[model samples]
Target: MKTLRHITLVVRDYDEALAFYVGKLGFDLVEDSAQPEQDKRWVTIRPPGAGPQATTILLARAATPEQSARVGDQTGGRVAFFLSTDDFDRDHAHFTAAGVTWVRPPVDQPYGRVAVFADLYGNLWDLIGPVPGGACVG
Candidate 1:
């Protein structure tokens, strides 16, 4: 079966995105390899404590104006990313202390407890934790 390895996210600076993901969000930096020939680096991160093969996000630095424009809102002003956690309250408290901008308070959905928050560049994301005996999307 085919499996996803990484999803590329356009970022203004690789290091800034790294700090946000690895510092505030507590994701693990999986790969940081220099591509000297191409003048770029391959920077990838995974969810904290998630072993290899979990969905990894590649923080791709924007090399062009068009790419830079997509840095925050990559899905045309919609929340295109969903980050699921096993322990919602712990992460929610952590993110609150970290000063993450939220779109709304957490609410109980049929599938999970979820809240919307913005990335540093205003990209929306859903931080979700699945409810026991419930299903989830993405």
Candidate 2:
């Protein structure tokens, strides 16, 4: 079966992105290797406890003005990412204490408990988790 791999995320800088994703969000840095020929680095990160085959994020440094302009609004004012968690309260509290900005309070959706938060670059993400008596337990 074919599986998705990495999703490219444009960032102003690699280190800063790592600081936010790894340092704050607690993602695992999968790779960070310099590609001197291209003057770029291959950086990838994934959520904590993700399996080896799970999809990861490729932090690509913005190389042009146009790309930089879209750093945060890749989705045009829409939620750009979904961060699923097994424990909603745990992650919500951890992210809040870690200074993550919440754009929407947690709400019990039909599928799960969800909250909207902005990433370091202002990209919106839905922090979703299974809720008791909800249908998203799987």
**Each model's lDDT:** 0.88, 0.93
| Candidate 2, lDDT over the whole model | 0.93
**For model 2, how does the per-residue alpha-carbon lDDT over 8-94 read when each residue is reduced to its tens digit?**
999999999999999999999999999999999999999999989989999999999999999999999999999899989899999
- In candidate 2, position 51 carries an lDDT of 83
What's the TM-score of every candidate structure?
A: 0.93, 0.96
Give per-residue CA lDDT, model 1, range 4-71, as digits (tens): 97898888988889889899988899999999998899999988878877989988999998898788
Off by over 4 Å in 2: 135-138
Give the root-mean-square deviation of each candidate in angstroms: 1.6, 1.2
Off by over 4 Å in 1: 132-138
